[model samples]
Target: MGLVGRVREGTRPPESLLLTAPGERAYVDRWDCDVAAGIGLAHLIEAFFTSKAFRAERLALAAIGRGGTDGEALLLAMGAAQNFAAWTQVERRENEILLEDFAGRTRCWLAVTPSADFTTLSFGTAIMARHGMHAAARSENLAFRALVPFHRPYARALLMSAAHKAVRLRQRAVSGG
Candidate 1:
């Protein structure tokens, strides 16, 4: 089976940067992938942090912020960690988590929805990076809007890589490897 994530038509992010105070520009996007039914949040988190694409990001962030060398060890310890590199775990649930950057300009949400046959993994991002305090704002501003094209594909790649990992994990679990 192939590993790819897709966004359903007309389904907006359940929670997003769009909910903001006056003068703040908002933007949000989401991607979803199906994996083995038994997979859970910890598994997904592990796959995400260990994914090649994210590994690069981790190393880069580690250089400028918290050390990405922490790797899966850090992301897997979500229960105890309040900060990861520059992200702070703001909300934790049995199936979902929300993290925000220190500046509060960016937010990430990850979740898993398991059915009888497979689990749907979701990755969402919210950004408010472009705006003037006194400028007119409707939805997303130009700066963040401009980055959407690149950001969409990068985010999808990260999730897709993680999904591939999740599939491998499932195979291992099934085989007891």
Candidate 2:
């Protein structure tokens, strides 16, 4: 499989995926690191809301719809998270998801964030809120692991429970947890 395909299959993006196809595919999968990151987001979301896996997949797909990442020259690379959220709603029919020009709009949305440190945690939260959803407290646990550098052990344990709950929810959904 191609590097992009492998990345979707849970492998990290290898250097080979970054080759420029030029006249061949117009864009090479390797040139867009966000695609890998997008996969991560999808996996993360799936880990949280098993019943909502389809929505999470739709969110990930929406996030990448605009040329994988570099489709828009003006937006920051991180803004793709917003696109993912936006597309989820569009796909869910929770809102009217229309693009005047699909390619152009995707390009514009992809170019919306320019900062290297833009985390879509807030954006994803907002989308979750709109869907009347919240991260299982278990995320706070993962956040604890993620925030060990910040030294918030108590908070980490709390969030870890949420993460654990989320995992159980998925397990139950899959195997009756």
In candidate 1, position 87 carries an lDDT of 78
Alpha-carbon RMSD, each predicted model: 4.2, 18.3
Best by lDDT: 1
* Candidate 2: segments with Cα more than 4 A from true spot: 1-151
Candidate 2, position 2, lDDT: 19
User: For candidate 2, what is the lDDT?
Assistant: 0.25
Q: How would you encode candidate 2's per-residue C-alpha lDDT over 63-130 as one tens digit per residue?
A: 76622222221121222333332232122111111111232221101111123532111011110111
Candidate 1 lDDT, tens digit per residue, 53-159?
A: 78878787778866444453444445655666667777777887777777777887777888887788877777855645655543446666778889988988888
Shift of residue 79 alpha carbon in model 1, Å: 1.7
lDDT (Cα atoms) of all candidates against the true structure: 0.68, 0.25
